[model samples]
Target: MKRLPGHGLRRGQAVTVTVDGEPTAAYLGESVAVALMAHGDLSTRATKGGENRGLFCGMGVCFDCVAVVDGVPGTRACVTWVRDGMVIERQDGPGARRAAPGG
Candidate 1:
């Protein structure tokens, strides 16, 4: 989806977050999904059938926006607020796993 200029309400302090190793601009109070979608990133994970999925409910009810954030797996981007220096990665599937800490 193409986002228009001056979309949504005014945002808070601007910050940088990494999505799949690429830095993107984000706001402090907005959800990670919102920030990513603003950058034209609609897919956050792939289904078991290899189908891409993204935000659905925009609320925490739906798990479609799940992604690996800050080294943690199964994080819902819709409810998780963006933080500076956050590292988010797209999930391969619903059961995607992250590498062992310090491994």
Candidate 2:
């Protein structure tokens, strides 16, 4: 769902966040899922079978929107707010691991 301008909804200042090694625009106070979805990134994670998954429930009850954030795995994007320079990546599987430094 694209946010149309002139809606009169107050939004925080725009900032950039990195997703899958690419920079995307996001706003303060919005959830990480929102930031990713707004930038046309519908898939937040992938299952072991390589099936893409996206936001199912806006709330954190559902685990469909789990992603790796800031080198941590299994983070729920729906409840995590977007921060400037935040790094986010889709989880490839249940055993996704953070890359080693300088590798």
Q: What is the lDDT of residue 35 in candidate 1?
A: 74
Write down the lDDT of every candidate, Cα atoms only. 0.82, 0.84
- Structural similarity to truth (TM-score) of each candidate: 0.80, 0.83
For model 2, give the RMSD to the true fold: 3.9
List ranges where model 1 is wrong by over 4 Å.
Answer: 1-8, 95-103
Cα lDDT tens digits for candidate 2, 1-103: 5678888888898989988777999999999999778767698888888888889988999889998999888899999999999998878787484233375
Global Cα lDDT for candidate 1: 0.82
Q: What CA RMSD would you report for each candidate?
A: 5.0, 3.9
Give Cα distance to truth, residue 13, candidate 1, Å: 0.3
